[model samples]
Target: MVLLERAMPTTLISMLAKIHGENPVVSEAKGVVPTCTCALMPKSGGKQGECKWCWRILVNREGLWFRVLASRYGLVGGRLKRGDRNGSVWWRDIASIRDGDASVLGSWFPENLSVHVGNGANTLFWLDRWVDDVPSCVRFSRLYDLSENKLATVAQMFSWGWKIGGEAWKWRRRMWDWEEEMVVECRSLLLTALLQVDTEDVWTWTPDPVEGYTVSVAYLTIIDRTPPTNNVLAALLWRKDVPMKVSVFAWRLFRHRLPSKTNLFRRGIIPSEAQLCISGCGQQESETHLFLSCTLFGHI
Candidate 1:
């Protein structure tokens, strides 16, 4: 370990990598011996995000030491030692645990690992800690290589199998809470789109009274809600006592007769739009000429 007078701000991995993973604890590879290779596998264990194989559980990389684990852990799915039988075989079932026996880790180990057990086994690995220079992409490849022994989802394999720069991490991975919430939100949005719930109900809406009435109604979703809200006057010409669009003429008269911003209709204050025009034979074309007092239509 190196100590410095000034502080050095760095990433967690860089810090750990500097002190430990930087140096290969074991000069030889783990699980490379010709011994039994029965990596512990989970029978039904992805729920807790823990590896089922090699019951040696860990929260993160801090627990990557073999000395702390030793015989207490089951082997995770990894390379098989030379004499290693299938997964069902154990040290107890090996029939022989001696260093040269073909059925145990002791047998196929390289000369460095061929010595005493425990401390020696630990020493071999301490000298051979993982090669730090291997890119994270390569690190992921190692994991996937080990993962091939078990069932895998396409997403999982793609996630770990992908290699980019020397470093690798889940590029677009979501946390459990975020993933769950987004799934629900997306499902609802999709359903609404399929049902067309936010569309206009034109068929059930009141029919347009003129060529431009539909456009006016379209603008009415928020600006106006009924016929009275429109600047144009409306009259029920098709189904009323006045069959000749008389009501249309009547409201038209009412609008121009009143002043701008007039409350005439608001409280029935003023006269008609026709009243604002000349009263026939005169200066203004008031309602008198168009219908009632007009000399044109013959004084209705």
Candidate 2:
């Protein structure tokens, strides 16, 4: 079997070092034994990257922390019921940084977050994830990529006259056949949402059924977004007769993460070898060949 050092992220190994309990030392060794619960989780910044737990703690503070900070600084930011110019500016600056660690953390949010359009002053015309719970940019990505102005606001797009600081139509005057079709599609979609200029824009958090953000709801949202895996033969793993450890091994095997020669070679745990079959076949080793196809092992 592969050692835990070879399998888990290095940051977790470092965290395990700081824990002090009856079995204080968390080793790099791998076995079927369960780890101790007394291990202390590492704080914020660590060797590999900012802790995801820490990142969540920070991002979820958008509702409360920013307001407290803004009140202290004589400025405003974060989620709003009735959008104001100062609050809108504050949110735009923070939300649209569009890169690095902060951006990565922001992507963890599910599509459940939505905007309640009012005056449309605070809502971004294209970049923000709003239409049918998806960003207009993502929905009409091709058109967004081709558009001359990428950062236009919804108010600007809906405004009738350029005389009052409304944006003039900035799309390319000439369009290819495909682009023309996309434009038609965009027009059809946009025509359905009419803006109410007198009303104030409301940023809505819809992760919970009750219409507010909660720690539990956020945690559930994150859990719901786990990356999908295709474990086609997973049924064999949960059979009543199988040992728990064996089921775990079977699960890892399906993920192509078992400590096979090919996995070790691919994971850089061992140097490349020309052959791996115990029966002396010269073929390259892989999960498929090791468990299902190798002439010697397949029949076992």
Candidate 3:
């Protein structure tokens, strides 16, 4: 675990802190749980330094973890889609991340990840972002609503023929002239989509296609997309020279996770009347007051 901690990038540590809902120091103390490092191992004859284990189950479809989940819950567009009530707690958590319910990590997956249609068996015809970086369902909402085969795969649609007057165009009702024009546009969009009969569909990490997905890259991408605020200070909090306890203290202070009287009252750990500065300054013992504004402690 210490070796894993050493292997982890500082940015990734911060990201994991956010995920685990704890300060980096506490998270580090817990240590990263062991996962299959087989996926992290470099391919035969590949670069020696390329091997690094990351918490990735989405893109590593061939990995044992992915295969086990896929076998149980099934997959759509090389991903586990929502609506599996029978899935395990872990699956639900992963689903939340994949479906954009887990905050930044959730949103990051869809925006930075994409699918390359090969055989198209693993690619959703409407939902996967295989064409032009946007899902067909999102691009052609009306057509998608009217279509009967909403869950159909790209290979299934192509096999049924996606062109005009094809069996793939199973609509709920006859479309008006304008809607038919949308169908025309949709068909034209699929004209260039050629599926490979021999190759399987694959997910591509858009930021680094060749190197593929890495937690470090994903963390950096999230940081980049996040509007800069206290980010600079947050980045500075994690330093090799600084003690872990100090960094954790700073992190808690910044995020209001400290056990200040105000925070304790807020969490129902104490009564409101008890939420006063320990120095008896009359001000609430909030983080700011205790750390920066208190007449007694502020001097130090």
Q: Which candidate number has the best lDDT?
A: 3
Residue 72 lDDT in candidate 1: 27
- TM-score each candidate: 0.15, 0.42, 0.56
What overall lDDT, based on C-alpha atoms, would model 1 receive against the true structure?
A: 0.28
How displaced is residue 237 in candidate 2, in Å? 29
User: Cα lDDT of all candidates, in order?
Assistant: 0.28, 0.50, 0.64
Tens-place lDDT digits, model 3, residues 108-215 = 566666877789887788877887767888889999999999989998999898876799999999999999998899888887888899998777778889888654
Model 3 TM-score, all chains together:
0.56
Off by over 4 Å in 3: 1-56, 75-86, 101-106, 228-300
The pairs that clash in candidate 2 are none
Candidate 2 stretches with Cα past 4 Å from truth are 1-106, 160-168, 209-211, 227-300
lDDT measured at residue 140 in model 2 versus the true structure, 0 to 100: 81
lDDT of 1 at 135: 19
The candidate with the higher TM-score, 2 or 3, is: 3
lDDT of 1 by residue, 1-300 (tens): 013201322243234434543421221323211111123211321111111111122111122222213322333322112234433333322223212233222221121111111211121111111212221223334332332223222223233432322122232343356544533442343232211223321111223323311222333331233334232233212224444555555455445543322334344555554334343454244333344344654343
RMSD of each: 34.7, 18.6, 15.9
Better model by lDDT: candidate 1 vs candidate 3 = 3
lDDT by residue for model 2 over 1-300, one digit each (tens)? 125224545354334434522232322232111133212222222111222222222334332222322332322122222234544433332332221223333444434456677776666777666556677678888878777766666776777432323343456666679986776676666756777879866555566545565444554454366533444245435656557887788678646787777778777887887437666776667767765567887557
